[model samples]
Target: MAIKVLVVDDEAAAIDVLKYYIDMTPTLSLLATFTDSRQAIQYCMLHDVDLLLCDIEMPLMNGLEVAEKQLGKTAVIFTTAHTNYAVKAFELNIVDYLVKPISYERFLQAISKYKEQFPTSVDDHFFVKTGTKGHLERINIADIIHVEGARNYVTIYHGTTQTITLLNLKDLEQRLPARDFLRIQKSSIVAIKHISGTKGGSVLLTNGNLVVIGPTYKEQVAKVINSKLIN
Candidate 1:
């Protein structure tokens, strides 16, 4: 089934641009487009939607407010010109934040990341501790790598640099968003983001790290790879 999507923005031009991209993607279908924030909320409350693309500067209620109200029902992707809202948007657990004049490439990249992290239709986030120095790394649902288990702690590897932290894998797992991270084995949990290629009983990550896919995790690995859904 095509993903049910809603585009909300007071600007008619912005809505048209988003609609163009939505029409290009075969896996996605537009259910409704709203110029008013209140109307969008009403429709969302009444119906079920897979994804929501909303503008932050609406008159009645802002995108952040709408996202808080939606909770976990739909994947929220914010579109706006302001960069200051990046941090705040992260707090809302949004799927992706696109700046104004959003290009087709960037939009597609965001959706690609979204599908990779949310293969089973579950939307969520994850957290990792870098060290005991009162510092914690909170990652978006898509930006995680395999958690390597050490003797007394687990090291979280993400971004360009491999970050190792002083926290046990078990404790970290409990703190992380359950739906987004899946334990492939006792010692390792690979992020849906870093995964690049998969075959047999192993998976290749974007960082060039190859990890073994345990028997129990085979289904999850396959699902993650297939969810990319790109031709």
Candidate 2:
């Protein structure tokens, strides 16, 4: 299903720009356009809108107020001329904030933020070519444990078997889902679910293997720990 979008801006130009962007994006579908915040809120409550591109300052209802009403029902991306509203708008757990006149590039950036927070399409499995002529193997994404890579080859470890492919770690890393995988070091990447524990500078996998975490990645590792474990 397409990600249903609703444009709620008092300005006709803003609404037109957003509508055009929504139409250009392959996954987005505009449900409706509203110059009135009240109507937008009412329609969203009665329907399903994946994202609400709303303006902050309006006659009856501001975007902040509109976001409050749509709290759990819909995700919001605020459009405003004032930078002052940025702090308050984020308090409502909105997807992104856009200051008009919103460039197409900036608009796409906000859409990317929405996509990352709410991933719509995730692959169940991916294919890799083997050394044999025209032989491709399907690797289940969930079964992945860890990956070890060298300059010329990448080795994937899943359950009890390992597969070596011609792709490097940098190339293979992009194929896996970011939410479920992490590049722990220069030469290795580990599946987040397969991590049993962490030592000083290493990750312990459930399969009884330890992978060293690179120095450059220690900050990201610390952040994950603070958000998911320590906090």
Candidate 3:
């Protein structure tokens, strides 16, 4: 399936460039374009947007406000001429930050990053390098319950066993299918299928282990829960 994309910018020219890029890329589909940030936010709230490309400096509502409003609903990539907001943008866990007059090459790179974080499909299994000799270990995605990040490495918990891999949590999060996994904390990513319930600020896995949801991620966890709640 093509990745659904939404472009938001006050400048007509910027929108045109983004549209052109989206058209040139076969993996992406343009869902909508917006010159007004508020209108864009409304559309996003009503649609299933996979990726969002927005400009930082706008007349009525800035891109930061839009991102804050639509947080956790979609992955965001900020495009602007200024470098002042780069730090803040990363803090929001934005996919990428592009300067104005974005080159086709750089734009493609950003899309690649998005693809890494939100894979198109989930595989039945994946391989991990193990031990000092770098032996390969095959792991079924279904067997994974949760992943805990410890500084430079992540411990992957499976059925009765755990595998420690020298990979950062954010990078590991990108490798897993977004639909099957949820990043509840800076150091934790859990398989959605294994999440039995949520208690207060923590997620209870089927294995009976509790993962504390970070304050920054609580809103996102709540949204996920609301979506799954049967009315």
Candidate 4:
């Protein structure tokens, strides 16, 4: 069955781009598109939608407000030009926050994240093929410490060993459990349980590796740090 999707954006151009992308994706079916936030909310209330592609700075009712109203009714993927709302968006447990002028590749990555978070069957592990040899290795999700992306490959640090796979950071981020991992920078995703400290825009891992939090990711990273801090 196709995943039902509803798009809400104040800009006609943004909505058009999203609609075009939705049409191209075989797994997603467009239920409706609205320029008005209130109308979008009304439609969602009357229909069953699996995903909501929304914009944050819309007039009348912003995307955050809409997501708040929908709550458990639909999963939200924020499509906006601003990065400021990211902290609040993640607080709502939305699927993904996509910055504006979203590339087709990134849009697809968001869909992959949604599928991973709401899979039909529970998955505790995933496999990654070894470099060149084509041997598939099973990896327990809980054993991962962090993943670091370099050039075209990502190093998965798990247990006492690390495996370098030919996968980008965005793709790897979607595969990991969102609640257990977070993208602190463009090139790094850290396991929440392995974070030892956060200070001066850097995350200290249990292994003593410090990952610098990117400027755009500060708020989202701070939320994680704040939640874990003992007061």
**Root-mean-square deviation of every model:** 14.9, 10.5, 14.3, 10.3
* Candidate ranking (lDDT, best to worst): 3, 4, 2, 1
Clashes of each: 0, 0, 1, 0
lDDT of 4 by residue, 25-119 (tens): 54577899999999999998899989999999988999999999988889999999999989999999999999988987699799999998877
TM-scores for all candidates: the values are 0.52, 0.53, 0.53, 0.56
lDDT of 3 by residue, 82-170 (tens): 89999999999999999988987699789989988986664577778787586888778788999999998889999988999877665
**Cα lDDT, all candidates:** 0.77, 0.83, 0.85, 0.85
lDDT of 2: 0.83
Cα lDDT tens digits for candidate 1, 54-148: 99988989999999988788899998988889998989899899998998668877787778767753334555566567777676545567677
Strongest candidate by TM-score: 4
Off by over 4 Å in 4: 1-49, 54-120
Candidate 3 global lDDT = 0.85
Query: Who is ahead in lDDT, 1 or 3?
Result: 3
Off by over 4 Å in 1: 121-231
